[model samples]
Target chain A: MRPALRPIVTLAPLAIVLLGLFGGGLLLGLLQSVGLFALTGSDAFTLSHYRALLNDREFLVSLALSVWVASLATAVSLLLGVTMATALHYGSFVGASRTRWQRTLLQVPLAMPHLSLALVVLHLLSPSGMLSRVAYALGLAPEPSAFPVLVQDAASVGILLAYVWKEAPFLAVVALTMLTRVSRDFDDAARTLGATRWQMWRRVHLPLVAPGLVSASLAVFAYVFGAYEVPLLLGRTYPAMLGVLAERRFSSVDLIDRPAALALALAMSLIAAMLVWVYLRLARQLVGERPVLF
Target chain B: MTSDSASPVILRGVSAAYGDTPVLRKVSLEIDAGELVALLGPSGCGKTTALKVIAGLLAPSEGEVYFGAENVTPLPAERRRAPMVFQKALLFPHLTVAENVAFPLDVQRIPTHQKKLRVAEALALVRLGDFGARLPRELSGGQEQRVALARAIVSAPRVMLLDEPFSALDETLRGQLRLLVREVQQRLGITTVFVTHDQREAATMSSRIALVLDGGIAQVGPARDFFTKPESLAVARFFGWQVLHGANGNWLAFRAEQARLIAPGGDAPPEGWLVLPAKHLFTTDLGTQRLARLRLAAGDEVEVEGPLPYVAPDAAVALALDPGCIREFPADAPATARGW
Candidate 1:
């Protein structure tokens, strides 16, 4: 007979804790779908609710809007992010006081909360906001109304602005992190080969960090999709994003629409899952398997 | 262009310090073109920092560096055209082996056709003609480092800095890579500075060596002279154990090879030179010569080099000392060693 094992006995508590967290999340999702031991037993699984979700146009519009806003925001943020990171990384901007202040200010945006960041955007870009106020004082505008429609305006411009304010910093941070891993040796090699700083970045640094930027942008895309509060406060009605639509569905007073709310949530979940999968798949295709581990 | 590639590259009144922490003090040397110079010392002897300054990756706190007759002291690393290979195989992992070798040319925007030809030539010179298509990960560690060398010389840089490039490899692999680097450096006539902490590495690779101690060059001379006869007491002890005597208020020093194992009970040691065995014997493997350690009664262990085949362990072997290896040091000197 085997002896009572000391190591396994000692490891029992850790094993229970690990499985409780890792396995419990998916199990809870499965149980809620099946109405197993839920607080409300009446909401049982049904095929019609799921079918109605597929047929609903409002849910579909919100889903499409999520993708549209996320992709646009991610693309614009990457362009801005790459520009800002490169300016700071290789530039002797450290010599100028204003550039130093700007560099310090760059870290501030990443630390600020998204809601706080949205407030910052609203304060600075609203028709009656800081820029408009300055314009009013300069006689550029007859009144605040003379300013262009910015807050809750069509084209999702205000919402996209707010999203980018938060997301661009995140992208810049990731870009800087990736840039740090580019070994000086490779750059030195490039220089000896007679590469200018810009040329070195184009040939060496860009290829090395491209994969990380792709993944960072994908993450920003996902973050933009799931942001419920940002669009709820800042988004337009004509092209309502998915987060705003999902919030509306969950808060509807009609009792019969509850199933449709669950269906909308599940639909949003499915789209997000697909985007994430496709993003990872395409990144792997482009970058291949081997690069610097750091 | 350098006015004369035949003249030596010189460092004048060179001193480097970081935040009042002195790293190199009044250190200077002249390295000739087509010469292989080794900066030999234990780590933190400012060997790597010196190489970096020469490569222009670092601007020395003081003094100027000259390539032949022209002063290129203030130039950026790229403008200086000094390529360096790091201890780790620091290849551009993102690029394929061929693309990696082609990187310098691509950066310079060489015509696509010429870039390919240079890459082929560089890879062929390094005996890696067929590895161009493979990524660095596909190749072994030594192969990856060889690709780095190919990239370095593809542009035909005037100076090469090797910061212990092969130090990470095993002994056998290191020897092979050493030969490869030596042959290629010779063929290209690139003035090379190799920084290594291992005495054996410094001894084997360099045409000449500069010994560094306490952030300064202690001695600089031909490798054979430095190895066989180290002048300073610190340099003497750094090589191995030696016996010292006082004559005319100066300290006279000779190697452990002068002392032999006679019958144990001793009133005093023999006239030529004497050392009593301590407690340890470290077996060292030098390429051409194998050496055994003898611990003297003074608790100092000195290495005795002879025609060694394989001696029995702990057997008392008589040493035949060559008095020519004996060196004398200044009596008032301080203690400092720059060795393995």
Candidate 2:
């Protein structure tokens, strides 16, 4: 084999899997959404499914809820993750063993599956859960019924909580890796150059870590936007997340709703792709010809 | 650029450590205003740690650092205003060269026009004026270091600390940068502490060389004194002096250039010279001269630099040392004498 072709050949397995499974599924879904590949024997290609989705208030509400939940979750996670990462990094200087334990504890949520984490969030934040019981025991609440409705609420607070809990640590791990790669000399240099701690963070550290944080937050945003299980377990029934709404339509008893479900999925994919393009452009502007992501 | 008149820096009984391992112990030195002092030592001898203490990057466990008459040890590095250049350029990669040089002024909230003017002057000082708009990655290694030097002096700091700033460069670049640093330092008259393991670098750059050993200063004096009047046997050996045992348990130290090889039965040696019987071991040919290694009768090897003698290997010869060049120390003298 030619040397140049060797790398292509070596990468063939990954390419085949990605194109065959993900690409093929996406192509099929797109065709079905446009009204082809109908089980009812009508093979007409039409935009009726997307047009119906655009006009439907239920679908619009679901779309808005998904956008709201994902954006809030990602923003909260990025902020918390950066804070946690910085704390762990500087905390190591005070006590290495304590920081090590805290780092290990952070990893516990990351190790569990998202569905399992949803259950954990449910047990902690539900009306009759541990927090409510403690509130009642302290007489802050008259009973479990008096506790605020956190789970299965219109705000999707439970789903957002679960995502922030699961994704913050994931983002923290990414930020920490970038932090460790940054030389300590940069900090010392900033200090000697008369930068206070906050100024050092704003000028030196934040820019240095922004690319990694943006990349990780993009991943979390994309994942939380499409995930269904958490919303199914913790969301309101009236206005569900796009993922849960699409899944309900896909599994409906009527065969005619399938195209709308596929349309919703394609819409989600389009939003994610556009977001990724914007993020890539922003990252390019940040680092200036350096490779931010491969 | 308007250079601030430099202030004297003093470290009094400064001791520091990394974690539990102590790096500097009761290390103290006083640098006069506008003087360049080199903390000269081998690797891991705590020279860099001492420099860090002075820069306020590392707090000394014990001792006070004073800038002129003010006790500055309690202040943080940001408040101290003593900038340091590290071994690597360590320019902020994200910022342009001009912005990196303007960082100190930006932190201190200097006026925008003044910051730009000072940054331009600093760049011109380091001969990097045109490269200000470029990023650090666009510059070569030597250029990056020059930008770092520009950044260090841009604020017209009263004191500057350099930790082996040119060590990572090629020899030619190192030589150029050493001269550049010395010229800039002299022109600005900033009190500077330069840390280097290279004795030649120390001798070439510093007004006084402080020889640090075992986490303490063994001696601190003018470069010439390190050779002519080393206080201890260790200080003499460190400066490449050839030490030999003399009669009555005395140790004699002399530079290789101070000793000469004499053929047997040659003219009578000059008065007040110490002559020892030796056998030629071998000769190393340098471009300008040959260095002949000879074994003295007392079983210690010594080098004499000159044109190689006509004698072959193992040929008997007499080595004559000038009494003026030889520093005699009693056998019981301390290996490392404390204080300056």
Candidate 3:
């Protein structure tokens, strides 16, 4: 087979499937948002839905809330992930059996389904759930209700916790792989050159892992921004995440709300597209034309 | 220039093991200050392990490491201040050549101006002054190694450990870098330890060579001593000498170049030389010289190097082994080391 043809032949099937399903649905959704396709009786196209969404205080707040939660989750996960990965790589937590267990434990979240992890987070943080009961039993709170409304709290703390719990492990795995591929001699060289342990990480390991970490963080940020299950289970209804808002609008009994729902979906997709574009540009600057794993 | 004299690196009865596998056993050697010594050996012979022990990267299980009068056995590699240039240049890919060279000074909390001056001087010493702004990936392999050399010497380390730093380069580049390392070491007058499996490289780079066999020093002396007189049968063979089982179970070694071929019915051979009947098996032309392999009457084979117009295969030849070139191993020394 010709070399160029080989790649096209191999990738064609997958490309066709993705473009058919995802691209087709995205096009249909964009058109529907502009009143091109609708089950309701309105035949005229207008920007009213988008303009309404922009002006609607709840929709605007939901979009801002989604961005805030995702950013906070990404920042927390990146820091925790890199630290854990470094610790694991250097054997700060050791013993042959224990090291294996620790590695597996660190990656457990990676294997977990998002909905399942969200359920666990909800149970642990809800007023009447395990953590609240434990706090009450320990006399830290007079009752479960006094433990603070972590689950479904207005701040989306429970949602952030769930996202961090699941996503940090993925970023940690990326960091660990990058660390393992790099030569340990660089660390030794740094130390011999008079660098302290912190300096070694700051100077050697950080630079080595930064590109990979940024790519992974962008993925986590995008996912957290668009993910629905965690926020649905753990977020308040007043300022729901964009995904929840879109879902509620799309599932409403009235059929006229469909275009607005599609509008929100199109907006979210555009935001994700912009994020990916920004990541590509930044990745080129950060990692230099090296083939990005993402 | 280095203010302090080269710190004598001493490893007293050092032994190291990786889990259950012993790599070095009770290895003891002392290198004088300002001396460049090559730890020469085959791959997996623990020469690198010994260098690491001296650098304080690996603490010996049963011995002490000393830098001059200071017993630095407990010191970390950073505390010992012995920088190593690894087989790969290992330049921090993220940093420019200047930053890499200035890393040690930066770590030591030297002022920015002093660090810049030293980095510049070090890069110039390595003949890579113009490459300071370039990243390691931007440089050629030889240039990367030169950058690594600059980094190693920028701090005026107490001891410089080179772990086959030029083995990755081509032969021509290897020779050039070898000379560069020698010039830099002499100019700085710092003690250096070089590890290499290539005999010619070791011989060319160091003032003295320590032949490491089975994880211990088989012999240590001037480089010529290894060629002229190898202390053990293994060392002789390692130097490409032909070790043969001679009269009454004695092991003897002879260099191919020292063995002369004569007619079977020639006049009496010289005194102190052994005469043996041999059949020529093959001969190869090596440009300036001819090498012939012969089967001895005792059913063993030996090689002889002589001028061209070499003998043909299956021809009868009388072999005269020069006495000066032959050395007999002690009766108790193992005839051949197990598993090489």
Pick by lDDT: which candidate is best? 2
Q: For model 2, how does the per-residue alpha-carbon lDDT over B122-237 read when each residue is reduced to its tens digit?
A: 99988998998999999998999899988888887878999999999999999999999999888888889999999999999998999998799989999999988988888888
Whose TM-score is higher: candidate 1's or candidate 3's? Answer: 3
lDDT-best of 1 and 3 = 3
Off by over 4 Å in 3: A41-45, A92-96, A272-293, B1-5, B245-249, B264-272, B337-340
Native-to-model Cα distance after best TM-score fit, residue B97 in candidate 3, in Å: 2.7
For model 3, the local distance difference test gives 0.86
What's the C-alpha lDDT at position B259 in model 2?
A: 86
Model 1 preserves the real interface contacts to a fraction of 0.70
TM-score for each model: 0.76, 0.95, 0.92
Query: Can you tell me the CAPRI class of model 2?
Result: high
* Residues B1-340 of candidate 3: C-alpha lDDT, one tens digit per residue: 3727579988889999977788998888989898999999988899999998988778788988999999999988888889899988888988889999988888888999888889999999999989888888899999998988899888888999999998888999999999999999999988999999999999998989988988888889998888888887788888988877788678878988888776455456688789888898888988888888888888889888878355667989877887777898765676543332
lDDT for B186 (candidate 2):
89
Candidate scoring better on TM-score of 2 and 3:
2
Q: Pick the candidate with the highest TM-score.
A: 2
* Alpha carbon deviation, residue A93, candidate 3 (Å): 8.9
For model 3 the local lDDT of residue B104 reads 89
Give the clashing residue pairs of candidate 1, or none.
Answer: B276-B296, B276-B297, B277-B295, B277-B296, B277-B297, B278-B295, B278-B296
Question: Could you tell me how far off, in angstroms, the CA of residue A110 lies in candidate 1 after the best superposition?
Answer: 5.2
TM-score of 1: 0.76
